[model samples]
Target: MSGPGTNGAAGAPLLSIEGLSAGFDGQSAPAVQGLTLSVKAGEIVALVGESGSGKSVTALSLLRLLPRSAWIRGRAEFVRESGEIVDLYSAPKGTMLSLRGADISMIFQEPMTSLNPVFTIGEQLTEGLRLSGATRGEARERGERALAEVGISEPGRRFSQYPHEFSGGMRQRVMIAMALLRSPRLLIADEPTTALDVTVQAQVLDLLASLRETRGLSILLITHDLGLVSRVADVAAVMFRGRLVEVGPVGEVFARPAHPYTRALLACAPRLGAPRKRLMSIADILAAGDGPFGRTGRSPWMPPVDGDSARGDGCVLEPVGPGHSVAVVEPGEIAAGAEPAT
Candidate 1:
């Protein structure tokens, strides 16, 4: 898998995953199993899943950023900025590190962990820029410009400040600035606006969309926020038990979801600032053979595949239309065909 597709700018997918499975330390079950998706050039693919659904892990594995204790397997094909295809799963360390923070950057959920408090924000930003071949003076100027581009105010003043000195939204802007310093071809933003207020969230989301369009940046956005995904993502993939339960164009999936799980997710959302009614929510842990998507692995935590589930009751994903895929419950199943496996 040295080179599988055209370069990132060649009007093709920049990243592709096939049969990917990842397991954390001390767990026999994979946090994610048999996951697959692709990010076309200048397109944003949202990996939407709740807590423990392996959304973040999937992103982390792409750059081989997962801990050594974690076990990872399967195909991870990527096109570099130079337009060479490579298998990210087994990429050489030197090559991977070179691409990281330069060709492809990630803005993780927690800013504090991603940024070093000891360093000034400007220093943190300039460091990456300079390392990527910009002169020190150029790095400083570019850093300020990037911050301003993300809608941060008083960019010059903020550039000299430490991470703690900035508000949450400002800090996130700085993170974006750092991520975009080298104008990476692919950007992986994991829960970029999780804790921000609504107004700022909207602004940040808009900035992301704008940047993607203007810079022609391919992106893989991992988040549990359906609202954010609905706002910025071009394509959507719903994951349950480490498998892609549904995937398609954002508009298509959002308006007419084919998977039972995705439909349930929409039903669970608070409507137009409406308050939620008390009800038993879906459980977090899903067992294989217990849902429509079957176990692609040998773990109980995986959703059941069609016709192969324990009770022979679960369903698997089937392609619904051209370029659109989703899971559906099969006919004549347990619960009298009242399939809970969506």
Candidate 2:
């Protein structure tokens, strides 16, 4: 994992995650495993992968928001504006509460469900601010300004309205505003543009970029859209089946994909001039296997295909270039089907 917190001499990262793994109570296999990445100050690092590829799991693990049934392991360190680094994983419950909305905030994927149906926008936004030591009046004014910053037309009026009164785009903006109102040093945005139209998605992304410039906020953006990542991400991390297959500068990773999974994902993206065809699924690529990727290292964590436990962790992440790494997956490493046969 990039040796923790270091971003190739770019100074310390805002958030550094090292070897994080998580599994649900009833699940034999972990949802995420040995995931490591970093988001530097005033930069956007995007975590991109297909659905169920552990993107959301990594984000939730950082916040410790997953259910109690889930067991999480690893270290997530957040560097505050004060230059104090706090490990989120083992920090006390009280510390986590104080950091949640004040120093670190998150904008969940769906605003409709995230926002309370019965509460006014003002109430919802100011609640966190009030808890963070602001008076009711101070919180109210700040909440309105937050709304305006995210491009809300009538911040004052909208502040009094409930979540149902806002359109999908506006609702998403409100979510963004709520997250930014605390003036957090780091923001975890889990699929912030999901369900929004392309135009609205662009607008939301622009707002995030503006926030980064204006507030120097570090952002961890989790999404499946490569186009969106290319537009705003400074660095990109690609995950497949709970493992980070590749990570590096956005342009470099896109230009010279080293991992077989990364190459397949690029091939699957729809291009304007390209013909409409069934996109190649990850399963299809895995089935093709060594035919495409030569000299792959197998992962020891993966369950054996033939019900043999002999194969240890066979995959190893090797540096392919400066600030770039790819998992060399060996033959028989990724067994047939998403899960190995029992």
Candidate 3:
């Protein structure tokens, strides 16, 4: 396994997270607890949930990008140098510094914050490429190519333009270009298409798919849009609160959801072939039950009586269809999972 085969086998799963729980309060109960997920080479795994579900937190914890005050737990194994695993939580600062953009890169939700408003888009993009070992000239060349790859025309002049000069969609393309500057094996994209118009979003998604196919980059896409997730993800993980409620290949999960929470979520979405008389609303869920997860629902792990002091009727994640897992709990219990907000 020296060439393409080596890349396929060796470049597999740049990041793996197991039982990860992290938060700013450093409480025993993490904002997202007992989270287990992975990103494989050339694959897209979508992490979907409503607001406050800990999807973004999960990504931030992986890069150690959270504030110093926060406490992160669990083992994050980053594969590098052929079969090596590094614990991101307790790793030395040096390990973190090296891993940040080289081995695994991340694209945050907001381009304005991630990109320096003061610097021209070109300068910002060039800076990242340079930091990863590209010479200034080479970085410039790559930056231009990156912009073009992301569908930004006139990449050379745009390089000298600040973020303010670009439209929201253009800024997103710049962010994507910056993230793609290097041949990163894993990319954690937290709502990369947020705030973009529908047309722009479609373009960006297409660009992402093409880029992924060409480079075989593993992607962790965190978004609230189940439709978007279905478009890009090979597998989907649905979280509630801070727990994983269900996970499986995209098609199976969409076709026949086993978990009651899942059924409720899907019922909320507009089905192309089904009628749209009713939409699932959180308000309905809140009113129907005694707990935050809903009291009268058909699932377990519902929220506590007051949204605090959770009722521990933990549901076991059971397989429904092949390659699909759903948490099975008592009828009155709510699903204990984090909801990743937009």
Candidate 4:
């Protein structure tokens, strides 16, 4: 997987998203509103947020996988293996179909539901390769090799088995193998370890990290677990209510979070060897107003800005440090970043 151009070189981002917003039909507000982020080649960037915070919608929007009834507005630029950059939002359906599974692939959260119950493992693995002009014999060899690469022993036997025959960990490995069959430059992993136990979760995370190093792969890891982000990600992007509140190197953001939401998330993480106290909930943070910052009257649920337009004078993302940004509301407005009264 390592090649001349595969190394993490200083160049344009592999994937760049800006001003993205998506909404289903009959909905007035978008699920993802004005979101912006980027993933560099050979790097792991984790997008962290709770459920309904638009993390999954952002991924689907980039892949153009939403249904016809959904409306999307944004620019998702993907750099092709051939070094060509294309706007995914405006690209033709044919172009997108060709790019999917080859240029950019995704491993869905649940393997049981992601894998076809009716199709054999080999059949599902070879489907994309066969459609992309691979001969049956070539596809079979590659599929078996992929299974082996994913640490599955007896690839031949596993290839013939059905989805139900495999355990949860094995199924996840299969999903990773399938996603990597085409050697995509960018892989989007949606909560890859959500269902696994702590031990198995560590194994999967190790697998992903190894793949990134050996294959020079870039990954967009969507998860709500800061523990996972701290373990595997080089950069972390925090989302709140469909908006990106902060993004920076994982260590910096974890050590000195600038946003109130981020601080609350860190404070809620369970510490080892500490008193087994009641876990702090997001609701508690909201009720705390200023949250851990203790700025009186500052709540997580601030005034809702107009979602129809982009950021204006009412709010701005000011730099707090190198590569660290925090969204700040204009003074005198009841915003998420409202300061305490004197």
Model 1 TM-score, 2 decimals: 0.83
User: Against the true structure, what is every candidate's RMSD?
Assistant: 6.3, 4.5, 6.0, 4.4
Which scores better on lDDT, 2 or 4?
4
The local distance difference test score of each candidate is 0.74, 0.77, 0.73, 0.78
TM-score of each: 0.83, 0.87, 0.83, 0.87
lDDT of 4 by residue, 1-342 (tens): 221122335245899998888888987666777777888888888899878888998998888988899888889999998988989999999999989988999998776688889999999988988988999999999999999998899998999998999888888999999999999999999999999888888888889988988998989999998888887888889987777878877877888787767777777665667764465554554444352223532222222333332332244465666666665554455443333222
Better of 2 and 3 by lDDT: 2
Off by over 4 Å in 1: 1-10, 132-134, 277-280, 283-316, 328-342
**Residue 237 in model 4: lDDT:** 92
lDDT of 2 by residue, 1-342 (tens): 131222354446788899888888987678887888888777788899888888888888888899999899999899887887889999999889888878888888776698899999899988877876899889989998889888898888999999889988899888888888878888999999988998898888888878877887888899988778877778889987778878988877888877666777777776668875476754555543442234333432233334332232456677777788877544566544423211
Which stretches of model 2 miss by more than 4 angstroms?
A: 1-11, 287-312, 329-342
**Per-residue lDDT of 11-90 in model 3, one digit per residue for the tens?**
45667888887777646446777787777667778899888888988989998889877887789898875566888888
Q: Can you tell me which runs of candidate 3 are displaced by over 4 Å? A: 1-12, 26-29, 131-134, 270-300, 330-342
Considering TM-score, which of the candidate structures 1 and 2 is the better prediction for this target? 2
